[model samples]
Target: MPEYRAPLADFEFLLHDWLNVSEHYAQIGKDDIDADLVNEIITQGARFAESEVAPINQIGDQQGCTLKDGKVTTAEGFPQAYQSYIENGWNAMLGSEEYGGQELPYSVAIPVHEMLVSANVSWRLVCGLTESAVLALEKHGSDELKETYLPNLISGEWTGTMNLTEPQAGSDLSLLTSKAEANDDGSYKISGTKIFISGGDHEWTDNIIHLVLARLPDAPAGVKGISLFLVPKMLPDANGEFTIENDLSVGSIEHKMGLHGCPTCVMNFDGAKGWLIGAPHSGLACMFTMMNDARFQVGLQGTGIAEASYQGALTYAKERLQSRAPQGVQQPDEKADAIIHLPDVRRMLLTQKALTEGSRALGLLYAKQVDIVRFGTEEEQAKAESIVAYLTPITKSFFTDMGQEVSQHGVQIFGGHGYIQEWGMEQLIRDSRITQLYEGTNGIQALDLISRKLVRDGGRMLQNTAALFSDMINAIQNEADKNMALEIQQQWLAGSESLMSGDAFDTASRAYDYMQFCAYSLLAICWLSMKDRAAQTGNDQLASSKAKTCDFYIKRLYPRALMHKAALGDSGEDLAALSLEDF
Candidate 1:
């Protein structure tokens, strides 16, 4: 197994340069962030994840979770670790300042949170889901709703879950049968069965807040009928206190292939007390509020898994003895030269570095877009919102999909030792698999990108994207970054033109596939820009790594996006060409 090291330099470069996150704070009319503060926070964040959580990752996998007749007892040390995570401010990084959050930009939260995911995904999911819940409510919930739950959620005194799936309603929300009946007192009683709800029923908090999808008795049928509700494990009374245990209980905790530390519960609401979140029969829209965040969170799972595997690979490459270097006369004094000298091994390690950090740079940028939308001026806010909507699916799907690929590579690179539990490499592979399945499958993401998003409003989003690319490329050309920026600009144009001209079906997948391409592209640009910015008169290690990664990206991964583009088309008729009868 390889050893794990924080990609601090990569993180620092993205945070300070590509995103220019501090500018986000200024746009929001605040001055709470700067380079020094961002660095300190990230350093502390990495230290906490490495020291407190990383050690328990494999332990959690080996111990898994114990399901009693009802209660789910997580692996030992998990409870304490959860407390430690709370005691620090890690849980509240993105919460509103009014609710005791640092109110820092998502750019800061993005990388720091990725460190946790990379360090211990199974462990961090519980906390990460809670954070997602807080952000969603802050965005859509009423002031009163925010007052009641936001503080506890931010502080991690309580955790949250999103319940949208049932035995029959995984992908098709139209199949959901969860029932919510309205009360005269402006509330509702939610009674339904929800299965495969991650963090649905954890005992890590004083209470669990569930954002469930259900329907009213008089609601319209199908997707339009679905609505959102806030159902709690323990219903709070008028005084805003959870004095009584609500009827929302776990039917069972699902046994799964990975993420064993985060309890996957089959939650049952037997006439549980609930409150409508946004609008009646508009729950799906409101539920998507959190889903958007969760999707990106899932993307980070890919980046996180890649980073963990990369760390192990880095450790293995430097320490593991292998055949002599192909250069013919290197390390004559040792039993064998380190594998890091070999181009293929270095390629695998660099592959992880390039993809994982590239994913980080984009995720951080998207997150900063979220903060900008929330706090920027009117025009800035509108622009941020549009970009966020445009990129959400891509960010979510691409990173997770690619992360799984990278993890498989990471395991293979370690050879036989990678397969065993002791190495943690195989676990990374298994664990990375679920990110693609959750938060909507990557296939769904591709469809969302290619079909829904691209065609919506007659490709207005596509137009906006073209404009951004043009502006960026023009600037790059002016500054001698013409080749790199032009490459991305060309892809953007080709994607948009193909989609609009009825060749979109053959346009490959611009959303997810193009995202992976642009993920590296944007990061390379951001990293290069940041390196240049950080050293007006001196060199920066972060920038140096950035340069290497950018080169690797442009020279290798960035161009590969063409293959996926080559794969897209107008219909699945070709795929349906195969017949079950023929088989």
Candidate 2:
């Protein structure tokens, strides 16, 4: 089985040294949440993930979830591991305190989540989806709904799922035909078949809260007509006891290419009992609350898988014997030296390390923005919201794309063994594949970044992001660090200018490249910040690692931005010129 050890030291460095999260906590009136408390939480979370969750990862993949007689059964050890996860209070880390949660900042919760995801992403999906549902309910659900459902969901006694897509509607929520009819009892009867629903049907929890999007009677046409509904697998009686089964059934679990441990179901809702979340004709808006949260978590999924794959590849490269070193025989006693001595092997390993660690830092930086949005003052919140909006698509797309590449690198380092199932490298590729496709495909993420985030705002958010990069650059005292930061920022700005100047079709054609350019730039800023901060702490080992990784990123990976920038000039005319029947 592929091994996973949580990157606890890196987590501590990012939170305490790099980001200075303790100061943010105090500024937000969380005076009691000191460094010790944060460290303890991270420590325990790591222990649980490493000990309980990691052991089940391979077995879970081997024995994927099964559906029998309309019921879904998860892999062996999943339920027990989840129970331990709940008992350990990991699920409620970010929930509201009023609902019996820890209410920890996203900055803290995210690292712990990365650990869980790295240990076992398929199992982590159940918890991650539930957290997104909690956020949606906390923000948009009515008071009655919150009082009725939030406690159980937060406590992990109940689980949750987000159902947005139907058979005909994938990314286009406007074409959805799901129906929600209002009843005299002030609830609605929801009837729809939601496909590709992650954690849709599982045995970890008795009642699964489904935040579904469906159109109401007499509602307006298109997205504005959709309404968000809180539908559960079991109905609650007058006493608020969930004893009666709702009119919902699992059509079947998807036989997916990866993430087999997670049960992605074809859910059939036959007039299931549900309550309106937000006002009618505002379902898309309400669901966005969940979708955005899910998007960020999906980004973490990418980072987690990348970390896992990197660790596996690095271990294999060190122990596996291959051709002798180019200069001479480093190991005279053996037939050949370890593959790690090879220059090409080192190149792949360093690329994986730089990209994975850079993605991790970028994710944490994004999480800090989320914390500011939630707890900062009004002006701070406004600025942070803009940063959050700008970074969302980049985080989701870039991290997942990095995860896919890193996993592939792991397979390559393993050679033929990577393709075989026994080495466990192939599973990482299979599992990371979906991160690019779901939570909006990486392509859709690019379009959203260019059209909605970059273009619609008239470049105000881009300026705000630039200001942030400038702050990081100015803080670095070292000339080399400052130079690296400046180079990436210049590349990013040039790409942005190219994107802003073109016509709609031309800009849209280059959106993916522009997003990639922005991603690399943001990651560079993150790397520079980590290196500068580590130097200040006088931690030679940490500082050296950070500085070397940052150097590798700038010299090696940042050139990809140049390629993407050049592609931005294409205007997509060639793409549009091709006729449908040309093939």
Candidate 3:
């Protein structure tokens, strides 16, 4: 069976050495988060994840969630584990201080979140969804709504959910038939059946705060008619406590391929009392504040799962006796050598490490950009937002794809046992499959990257992205491996220019390849940055490992970027010309 151990050293290297997050926090007026405090949080959070959360992963997968009498009961120990999480104040760490939270920077919260996900992704979604809900309510919720909802939600006494997908409205919100009628008491009667609601209903808490997207009676047609609402399962009465049950119930829970512990529900809100959030017909905008945050968090899901898979595979490789090393017997005393001595096993393990570490770095770096967008100086805020907007789709799609790839490699290293659940490699693969599907399918993310972000702005954001990398490379021009950095920057710029020059269909057709190209190139930047920092520290072991990994990435993985660039150059005409009739 697989076990989880948080990658504290890698996180410390990224947060303290590579990204200099402490300086970042100080710059953003977050003077409270010093290196010592940050290390303590990472250590304690890891302890909770490994001890309290990880043990429940396999149990949850087997037992799943039970739905009965319109109430969903999570897997055994889930509620207790969650209560522990709340008691430890994990949920309130990232929220606003105005709502009884610590208001730590995303840079800090993101690592803690990564640990939670790596330890137990199924359980992580419970609070993960609430974090997004908090973002939406804080950004768009009225003062009254915030006063009532924010305190409890931030304190983790109550949980939250985002209701967007219905049976008819899969990805298209225009087909949503959910209705909201204005009530005489200044509330709206939200009546709808929302499907695919993660953590939609659970007995873990007394109240579940739902952020629903519904249309007002006289609202405009299609998406323009949509409005955001805060609908709680149990409405609060005087003194802001759960005093009355709202008209909502769990219709059913999804028997999904994985994440069975989260209790994805088909929620039926029949005339549920809800308060409007933000202006009418501006629901999409409000919900996006949640979606963007969730999208990046979903990306972290991929990184976390991949890290766990890699660790499991590594442990197995070191223990499972196999064929002798190519050169000689690695373990003469034993009948067979450990698989870790094999070349192919090393390749698989190295790929997992490279991708997992790179993805973690990119995710946290993206989170730092989020911090800047929220609290940086005005000029810094504008620049960071532009950069983050350009990278969001890349973060979501690329990281998830890498997760899938790394998880697959994990299973492969285990050979036959990996296909079976007893070893736990299969569970990682099953759980990670949804990361690519939900939070917007990776294909859709690719299309969005091409049509909306890269091409729509006439390449302004893409140019800004190229410039951002170029500046980083320029900053390290005097370093030992500066030439390699310059070469990567030039190649990225060339690829960006070529993709932007294409037409809509041309760009769309090559969007997936282009996304991969950009993801790999950016990861190269991360690896090289770490390489330079390691070289400077005179830590021979760390420097050697970074150098070997950097060389492997460049020599093996980096060549794929060249192939993608070549693929991107195709007009996609031959591919497009083939019609459904051709099949």
Candidate 4:
């Protein structure tokens, strides 16, 4: 099996040097979480992930999940491993302390999450979805709901799943046909089938809390009529004892291309007892609260997978002997030098490293903004929200795309061995393929970027974002670092200018390309920030490596934004002109 190790140094660099997470937390009134504690959490989290979680990745993938008699059983060792996870208090690490949680900031939780994702994406899904569900319930659920549900969910005795898509409803929730009828006792009966429900049901926990979306009898025609409900596998009675089973069952587990360890269930909620979460006919809004959180983590999945793939491939490259260096024989005593001597191999490795590291830097900073959005003063919260709104889709789409690319490069680096299963390289590719498809596809993410975030506000958010980047650029005094920062600023300005002047349709047509351009340029800015910090540290090797990577990103990757820019300039006539008859 390919070994997985948490990139602790990268996380530390991001948390300590680049972002100054401790000071930022202080600014947001999170005084209790200092840097020392943060580092301890990270250290212990890595040890747990490396020793406990990663060893099961390949085993889980090979064994997969099994279902029989309306019950789902996770692969061998998962339940035990999960018990260890819960017992370690990792599940409640980010939840609120009022309900028996650690109440760690999302910024701290995110690094630990990155480690979990890298060690085992499949197992990570269980806790990741639960945390998101907890966020939604905390944000929108009524007091009664919180009192009853939040304790168990927060304590990790029960897990949670977000049920958004059904057989008829995929991306468009308006087409949902799930029915919810009011009861005399003030509860409701939900009857419908929800597909693609991750961790929908499992024997690892006693109860599974499903945040379901269904329409009321008196509801309107479309999405506006929908409402959110808390439906659990085990319904609590009047005495709040969950001894009774709700009328919900797993129809079957999905035979998927990847993430087989996570049961993608078809949930049949037939007259299931449930209670309303948010206000009636506002289900979509409440679900978005959870989805937005999931989307950020899904984006980080890309970086996590990429990080794992890089580690595996780098190890193999340094050990696998092949042709000698192009310059001269570096290992004359050996039959052949290590594959790391090859230029193209280094290119692939560097590409993977740059994108993975850049994604980490950018993603952690985004999580800090999430912290501000949640805990900052009023003014800071408002500005952080706007920036986060613009960044969400980019992180969701671009990072996952990078994950896919990096996984493929891993396979290429290993050549024939990568295609083999025992090496565990292929598993990374298979696991990463789903990151692009789920939590809303990359295509849908692009539309959100174009229609909702960028164009909806008449490019105001984009401009504000650009101004923030401009401030970073203007702060640079070092000539070379300043040049790199200006390059990113100029590229961003050009892209934003195109988006601002273009019509909605034109912008929408090129949204995918625009997202790539915007993400790449933004990552360049992140690289520049790291570059400046590395230079100040005066560590020769660290500063030199950071400088080289920054130069490589600015020269090799940043130029790709021009391709997106050129593509965005077109009228999109060819696509529009091609009619159904033409095909």
Candidate 5:
């Protein structure tokens, strides 16, 4: 299949007519970023993603990566396409203007990422890791590290990866045994073997930078004693340019069920030259610098997948001829008009549209918050950070699970075409599954929702957002509306206390209802927010799409919030009662 034609009209509605992207731009001192620039970028990024990247997706998967000797070579066409993407500055869109980055609003950057990922997500993993590496380094690394690393990384000339997982330590970082020995030169020799390292070894860039988490020689046991290190594939000298190969090599890459385009390497480090990124024994917090971004990007991964799947399903429903109308002849022409003419198929397609579009709106909405938190003045910064902190994990976990469910539904809508590899429907399913697993699994995400996010700070965060949801819920629904969104807000608000407790894990699940409630709530608010502006500006089509999607989200898709409410309450002594013997 060709790359998706991004629903640009729908997206435009989400950003300008629905979401307050421009308002946030003004808040961040980028009031100059009008709708025109944003639209152009969306157009260009979509063209580049659909044309330059989409073709190579199946090629990358079919050819995978070749590891002969020590070098990791990507599938054919990858290097060339990567160069084109770099030459076009696709890699530097959201980079700091202090460096060479365009410093475009994150509002614009996220949608660009969604375009690229929706086109070819697995092939784009290296860029996500690169973005994450820049985030971690910019926030915590020394000035020397920042000056040397940020420019190249922001430009994508040098790629980056986070090395944290050991064979014995996947979710549990406490067991990692990587060692960083002091060299008396403000450096260390890091020796560790990290598994499941995406972009761990690649020839697309001149050099590879790794932020490794390792323990010191005299460090205490477990995660607290661990520290973050900046380890490069090649050692840099006086000029901050690589001069010699570092003592790290790729051991192997995992053969996963999907995402074959990305090389998840088994990295073996034999005293790799390393520099500590943050304070000694503070690796976990340092890794969080990247983890949060990585998690949100993973959420977008789900959004992109869901969007792609929805597009595929919508296209299939419109074209594939199937049974006659159920309500006695809605399609009287030829053998059949299309499955889309059927109400049931329309139901599935609408559900996908409602959730996928809602998810996209949430991601962009958060990106705007990122701008405010990073660049806003004192008063707004506090509020923006609070909102970002509040929404980050929900975006990650919710969107990922959405990708899995929506993609599976896409497969189902295709029936047999979904099952076969030729149609590429199965590929979507295979590709989206990893979103839940990578960047912390959905299980880890739910725990985070229960722990740091929902409950911490004495439940103040959850309580604060209740007002935002309530305001959106109060929006009037006309006779034309069919979605049940207000009911969702009622359910989520009612269950806020339970969600704040450890019992929250029992409250929600892998189904993403609670998460979706939050995600779609943001969507509804963003759309409604934009609608207020659109009505004044006289853009009816854009405003109408917003209204329809919002209504569709509430009545058609928001009911999942009901299921999540039940899911949360279901976590009880019964779940804990089952033991190994019972199983």
Candidate 6:
């Protein structure tokens, strides 16, 4: 079985040295969020993940989830591990103080989340969705709804899920046929069959809260008519006891490519009693709150998986012996040299390291923006909101794409052994694949980046992005680092201009490339920040490692941005010219 060790030192460097989150927390009046408290939380979270959750990974993957008589049973050790997770207060890290939550900043929760996902992403899915649900209910739920649901959800006594997809509706939620009829006591009758619902039904919790999106009886057309509903698997009585069963059932759980431990169910809601969340006909808007949170967590999922894959590959490379090194047989006592001595192997390992660490930095930066949006002043909130909006798609799409690529590299580095199941390299590839497809597919995320975030405001978000790059560039004293940052920013600016000037067809065709370009550029900014911060702190070992990684990223990986930029100019005429008959 593969092993996972939390990158505690990296977390410390990013939180304290690079981002200076402690000062930011103090500025936001969160004096309780010092380095010591943050360290304690991360330490305990890491211990729990490494010890409890990770042991069940292979067991879950092998046994998978069993659905018998509509109730889903998780793999061995899952329930016990989850019980420990809840007992440790891990689920309440980001919840509100008004409920039974710790009320920590989002940034503070991010490292803990990364560790859990890295430990075992399959199990982490349950916790991730519940956190998103807690955020959505806290932001948009009515006073009564909050009082009823927030406590248990935050306390991890019950879990939550987001139900948006149906047979006819996937990305185009407007086609959803799920219907909601008004009921007499201000509740609505929700009837819909939702597919691909993670944590839809699990034995770990007594009840599950589902936030379903459906249209009202007399409603407008398309997404405009949809409204959010709070539907629970078991309804609570006036005394807050879940004794009454609701009209919802788990029709079946999907036998998926990966994440077998987490049950992805086909849920059927037959006139389930539910209450309105936000305003009528504002379902999409309300759900966006949860969707945005889920999207960011998915990005963390990618980073976590990449870290796991890299660790496996690096361990195998050092232990596995191959042919002698090109220069000479350094290990004269042994029959052959380790693969880590090979240049090609070094390239793969460094690529994994550079991208994984870069993704971590970028994600943490975004998490800080989320923290500011929640706790900062009006001016800070406005700026952070724009940054968050602009970076959401990039973070989600880019990080996952990197995760898939890095995992593939891990498999390749292991040679034939990577294809085998026991080493766990193949599982990483299978697990990381879905991150690109779900939470709005990477292609959809790219289009969203181009259409909504970039083009909608006449490049205003790009300008905000450029200002961020400029700040880091100015702070860097090294000429090479400064020049590399400038190059990435310049290319990104030119690509944004190309996207803005293109017609609809051209923009749609090149949006994916543009999003990739933006991701590389943003990662460059992150690398530069890490390099500069490491040097400033007099941490020679970290500074040297970061500098070498930054150099590798610039010399090798950064050129991909240029290629994506060139691809942007293609107009995709050849793609459109191909007829359906060509197939």
Q: How far is candidate 1 from the true structure (C-alpha RMSD, Å)?
A: 2.7
lDDT of 5: 0.79
Span of ten consecutive residues with least summed lDDT in model 5: 476-485
> Tens-digit lDDT track for model 1 on 1-583?
3445677876766665545667757768767677899899889988988888888888888888766866778887888989988998789888888989987777777878888888889988888888878877887788888898899999999899899988999989999999988778888889999998877765577788898899899889899999888887887678967889887788887888998887888999988888888878888888787888888888888888888888788887788778998987468889889888898988888888877776776677677778877778888777777777777777778788778878887787788888888888999888888998988988787667666667654676666655654554554423555565666666655755566544444434344555554444455554444434544424566546656766776677766765655544334456557799866
RMSD of each: 2.7, 1.2, 1.4, 1.3, 2.9, 1.1
Error of 3 at 92 (Å): 0.5
Task: Report the poorest 10 consecutive residues by lDDT, candidate 2.
Answer: 494-503
Q: Estimate each model's TM-score.
A: 0.93, 0.98, 0.98, 0.98, 0.92, 0.98
User: What Cα-based lDDT does every candidate model obtain?
Assistant: 0.77, 0.90, 0.89, 0.89, 0.79, 0.91
Q: List, residue by residue over 69-145, the lDDT tens digit for candidate 3.
A: 88889898999999999999999988899989988888888889999999889999989999899999999988988
Over 265-368, each residue of candidate 4 has an lDDT whose tens digit, in order, gives 99999999999999999999999899999999999999999999999999999999998899789798899999998999999999998999999988987898
- The per-prediction tally of clashing pairs is 9, 0, 0, 0, 8, 0
- Give the better candidate number (1 or 2) by lDDT: 2
Model 5 lDDT tens row, 1-583:
6348877886786677556577867867888999888999999988988888888888887888878898888887888888898889999987888878887877888888998888888778989999889889988999998988899999989999989899999998999999999998989999989998999988898899999999998888888999999998888778866988999999998888998888889999999899998899999999998998899999998998898889889888878888777776656776866788887777788778777876787777788778877788997777767777778878888888888889988988898888987677789889998898977888777666656667666666676566545554455343122133454455566676656555443544423445655565556555454444455556777667666766666566655655555655555666568798999
**What's the lDDT for residue 357 in model 6?**
99
Which structure is stronger by TM-score: 1 or 2? 2
Clashes counted in candidate 3 amount to: 0
Off by over 4 Å in 1: 1-3, 237-240, 469-480, 501-537, 540-544, 569-573
